[model samples]
Target chain A: MTFFYISAAVALISSVLAISRSNAVHALLYAIVSLLSVALIFFMLGAPFAAALEVVIYAGAIMVLFVFVIMMISSGPGSTQQERRWMNFRLWIGPSVLSAVLIIELFAVISPPREPMSAKPVIESKQVGIALMGPYMLGVELSSLLLTAGLVGAYHLGKRKDDAAQTEDVTIHD
Target chain B: MTSVPAEYGLILAALLFAIGLAGVLARRNIIFILLSIEIMLNAAGLAFISAGSKWGQADGQVMFIFILVMAAAEVSVGLAIVLQLFHRIRTVNSDEANTMRG
Candidate 1:
């Protein structure tokens, strides 16, 4: 229980920091910390399989993709300077207050005493796999289809045009 | 035996989601916006896992796996579009990308 509270707090604080950072790399690093802490929470919740996937896929693969894009764009120091200017108190204060209110409301709604459920067995990876293959087979197949389409779309959208052609296309589009 | 109540797990998820929502509403840079969306998606996954744990069912974990798949596809295609947008506009400020705001 102590570990769960600690990790949950870590996740919340890091997520807040992740979004508020002016530098993209700094924000990405915080996001990674936030993700890892969430994974810890998942582990404590008796969903070890979900926790592992949260680490392997969410923290590893997805974040690396964001890092690669940030690297490729290579926003100079000037960009961070601009970001700093844009991320002022005026811009963030409203959202922060609104979110705080929402959270408080959620806490109120969720904190009411309720009957505790009987203890059940932990969900293992094997059970998850069986569930996926059995009743959720259609979802798995559809996700694969979505992945294929995303791959093709990304490739098409990301491909570079010839330099001269690009200039001409930009002129026409603008 | 799981020690923590399901309500606590849910509260944590709600907190994360709120933070993500604030990020999405506040950030101006497109990358940060996308990152905020990722955080929101993650919070949703956390909620599912917690609910699954409550019932001792594998379904929550299965749903999280699907959420993982959806997030991966979203980031891949989203970044591709971001790259294209940066190439065209030379800037990642969402406010600046309002050329199509007819």
Candidate 2:
């Protein structure tokens, strides 16, 4: 429970920073922290292998790309017209009401009678590797192909970083 | 008796999901939107782990690893597209990229 609370707190702070901050680099860092906290939460839930993969894959590789984008692009909200704003009351009212109802539902579940059955879980790093390459090997290969396609797509997209020169590329139909 | 109930995990995941949704709805930055999407994904993963505990199986944990791999792919592809869009349009803001929207 201590780990849970700690992860909750960190997640809250990091997520807030990740969204609210004006600086792109700062926001990316907050994203990293947010991901790591959730990874820790996974660990506390007896998913050590998943937790490590989360850190290694998400916090390590994906966030690195996010940070690289922020580095390449300055923190400015580029070419934004002054006609619109991010705030609108319609958006808040609906979600807020839903959240209130959800909170009430959560309170109802606060004190339940659970037998708290935890198994001796035999999940090791090796077991996962074997499972991936075993009969479930199809899943592993499919995902690897997906990941490779993603990398190729990313490379193709980012290779055209003519930032200032390509300003005429996006034609607004409005 | 334990200090915190086992179902606390579910509630926490719900909270994270809400936060992520809020981030998604309220933020206009593309990168922030992507990050918010990640928070939502993380919330889902946490819920799976909590459910795994309830069921006494490692399936949820295994599922989470796959989710992690997918998220990495998503982020890389997404941010790369964002980067490229910014380069072409010179803006990373999503509200302005409505050229395709009818």
Candidate 3:
């Protein structure tokens, strides 16, 4: 119970910090921490498989993609001072107050007495696989199709018309 | 198992959702807005998982798997658009991209 609370609190705090950071890379780092802790929360909640997927997919793969884009788009190392100047301490106040209201609301929600459920059967990966393959097969296939389409679209959109010219220019400069 | 209540999970999910909302409403960066949307989607998934746990069903996890895939697709498309927008206007700030304005 304490561990669950700790993980949830950590997830909330890091997520707040993640969104508030002026530097995109710094925000991504904190977002990774937030996702990792959310995975821990999932594990504690009895969905170990989901937790693992959360860590592997959300924290690992997706965040890596975000970092790659951040690196590609950043103008280089010369903007550190400018980024530092933009990181205002006062920017924390809005998120802090909103999160505090949420924490208060959480306490209110949890305080209400309700009928406790009978213990739930642990959901393992095998069961998830069966469920996915059985009733949700169509969704699974569609999601794969969506991913493929997204990949092609992203590739096409991200390709620069001047890519060859830019490379040649760089080589000449070198 | 420590036998945590489903309501606790719901409360946590709500908190997360609210935080994500705050981020989306407050941040001007397109990437941050997208990240905030991801957080909101995760919150919804958490709520589904919590409800599934409460009812002792696998449907919630199944739904979450779909949500995960959708989020991945959304991010790829969104970032691609972001990249193109940056190439065009040389900025990722959402407010600066007003070419579509009437």
- Evaluate every candidate with DockQ and list the scores: 0.48, 0.40, 0.36
Off by over 4 Å in 3: A77-119, A163-174
Residue lDDT tens for model 1, B1-102: 247888888888898899999999999999999999999999999899889988889999999999999999999999999998888878889998776533
Model 3 chain B lowest lDDT segment of ten: B93-102
Weakest ten-residue segment in model 2 chain A by summed lDDT? A79-88
Please state the CAPRI-style docking class of candidate 2: acceptable
lDDT of 1 by residue, A15-92 (tens): 998999887877887788788888777866778789789889998999999989987887676877765765666655
* Rank list by lDDT: 1, 3, 2
| Number of the top TM-score candidate | 1
Predicted structure 2: lDDT: 0.69
Winner on lDDT between 1 and 3 is: 1
Docking class of 3: acceptable
Clashing pairs in 2: none
Q: Is candidate 2 or candidate 3 better by TM-score?
A: 3
**Where does model 1 exceed 4 Å of error?**
A75-120, A163-165, A168-174
Error of 3 at A55 (Å): 0.4
**Considering TM-score, which of the candidate structures 1 and 3 is the better prediction for this target?**
1
Q: Write the per-residue lDDT of candidate 2 for residues A1-174, one digit (tens) a residue.
A: 544575677777677767777756556666777777776666556667887788887888777877677657664555232113323444344334433443343343243773332333535667656766775777788889988998898788777556544454643411
